[model samples]
Target: MPVIVLEASDFTSPLFLVRTWEVLSGCITFSLVASLEPPNPLSDLHSTFRIFCMFVWCFFFTLTLLIHILSIIQFHSLIPVSWKNLTMTTAVLGALMGLSASVVFAWMVMDHGGRLTHTVAAAVASCITFLAYSSETYVLRTQAHEQRGYMGSNPGLLKILQLWGGCNMIPLVMEVVHSQGSASGLPSKVLSWQLWVSTALYGVCVLMSLVTVVVILGDLAGRCFLPFDKCLAAFSMIGVLLYMVATVICFTKILQLKELGNRAPTGVTELIIMETVVASITLLAYTVDLAFSIKLLCDRSHA
Candidate 1:
């Protein structure tokens, strides 16, 4: 049995207000989109993308409400996971997903022809929802500093970005895999190998990141016999090296394919270019994480 202990302060807090706005705006955005008629054949992609946006909204809404309810009931300690980490993770993911949804939904709505007024209104609401989620993330960060949660730290946040970047590469990798047999040549083979290697490197990095996150969240960092800080520094360094290789491979191979003109499948060049950009950003994040990890290790040694 769970006891219900409502905290008035929780409801009155700035975080609560932002979350309320998120829920309201999310509802508005989805409702508007849902009310519109099904899109025409040409706009099917846009319609499907809008559905993704709606799913994002619904996801955050449900999670936010659940967190609120949990907090009100004072059940934080009963949960298996760290409440603070969970909150911070949700806030960060919500902000990223909200921003992506807002931009994508707005672009889809504006680029095509139909129900302009309603879609535009929905886009505006989506933007507001993004802002709300961003605000929540900011607030959570400030609070996290005081709470001293792992996910609130610099390295922890970088891990989330790294995960996102790795996930972004998946679509491009899948595209390449799907069109594997469509082309046959030395250039094609080389390009495929490059993409595969890059994907593999990042896949390893993402796996390490997930392991690190679990260690931290499970409160096993201190209990583990391993030299966690040193291992993290080593992992970060290796990740940086791997990302550097991946970045070079991606940019060089992609450029070569572009120059070859028709060696690569249609639209793949563009996807690879986008993936390269994400990889570049992810590489920078890995570098920063390496620095932070080293600093933490040094500080620990001195202490």
Candidate 2:
């Protein structure tokens, strides 16, 4: 008797690596968005919630990577043969990723004082998300008639995603254009105001996400929801909530220091410093995600 290695094609034989990676990349994004946490290089610098969020970020980050692996391993040689299927899958993933990315940037959209960069990013992303969601809705509806309205899709959250996406940049965009008070200081002028706005927005998004989650959980045992789709929605939501909380903390600190002047921490200072570190890490993550998604999709043809 000879031992044989199992190939992914035995099950869903049409799928292949690169195509699969694309789908996985978008799917993983949901968890990654929910898992963002500010990293602390200063041993003493700390926020309990922030720490917890970081842990979440790491966890989701891992999950995202793991899904990439699954996509690679499972579809290593099947996806390319069916270009039509592959294209459809890529579109679905893009739409999902766009929707999830909007959640990822919710904090940016909610920033008070209103940075135009954030506003623009949010707005552009939201349009992307809505377009993707609408397309997804059409696809889903075509496949399953029972999924009318998410069983508890909070209109409020949907509204926020839309409203926020419509305008992402306010102060930042203005500063870039006007150069008014764009000077470098321990605490940037725009930072505090942004913190306040982001914090408040996160607070609201959290509430909306929480309500939506409860509804999802309640319906878990019901007949309508698909396990994978429901799970995707829930996980992506976790990322949105984390951004909200972290952003709120940034806002609160700024407001507290508003009374202190130059003596203590300011919101702008904190975000600038914090984001400075996280930006590199997140960029790496995004690159990895893109490589996994696109490469996997492309690899399907090689097999």
Candidate 3:
């Protein structure tokens, strides 16, 4: 038997490039924001939170940058297997910072008599960034070995993912649309179509996810309609298809509603749409990678 050598470039994919950009851009943004005047000069609480948020972004993204550099250097074995933990930490910190910054932005809005100013816009951008990172973390979790294996120590992990998609992700998408729509002040007429379609698709996904859980459990109970692995893969493919469709619809509506050139909406709607598009693409890439890895694992197991 010949020994196979894996090179650093072998693991490099478009997703890796995208994530590298994500971390580097975030670092630059944080640096710039920190160098500027406080986000809200009048409110000490707001200014403090703004600084804190920038710090969090800087720290998290810098760590991510290091991780990528390690991967690029082919120090694969030196990289922690618990990489998902770093993602989870980043997600949690982002949530805290986003929410805190939102409070400051909200105060600014009320202070300015409910007008959508730059501060409000910044708040919305922070929220969208938070959502995007959270979604990315979800995708990262899917790639972890802990999420694989049907009869391993973590037997309920796959079931948990199914239920999470049904119970949490579907609702989360709806909330994101609702929030962005409200922020954009989109007309009821314009909101009806994309809103309806996206929600409907997510609803289907939710139902399918629930059915998948039941089918998987039934298979585990020895009443298999198909192999558990096959069922899981089928559900993953179908769910990804529906999700991508809904995400596309959402992106379309955002494009339709976006103002052009100098008259663009200074609110958070445009930023939310842009961030969602990036996150959706990232999720799609992650799903494809997961499928490919699973196939490779299956092949290896058979051999």
**Per-candidate TM vs. native?**
0.77, 0.29, 0.39
Model 1 regions more than 4 Å off:
27-58, 107-122, 175-199, 257-270
Worst 10 residues of 3 by lDDT: 149-158
What candidate 3 gets wrong by more than 4 Å, as runs, is: 1-190, 213-221, 250-271, 274-282, 285-303
Cα lDDT tens digits for candidate 3, 133-176: 55544555566465433311132333334333343333335545
TM-score order, best first, reads 1, 3, 2
**Judged by lDDT against the true structure, how good is candidate 1?**
0.74
Q: Any idea how many clashes model 2 has?
A: 38
- RMSD of each predicted structure: 4.2, 16.9, 12.9
The model with the greater TM-score, 1 or 3, is 1
| TM-score-better candidate, 2 vs 3 | 3
| Residue pairs in collision within model 1 | none
Residue 299, model 2: Cα distance from true site in angstroms: 51
For residues 99-141, could you state the per-residue lDDT of candidate 2 as single tens digits?
4344424433343333444344434534443354445334433
Worst 10 residues of 2 by lDDT: 165-174
Question: Best by lDDT, which number?
Answer: 1
Task: Itemize residue pairs with steric clashes in candidate 3.
Answer: none
Task: Give the per-residue lDDT digits (tens) of candidate 1, residues 65-159.
Answer: 78877777788789877778878877886777787678667655545554567878888988888898889888887763757487888778897
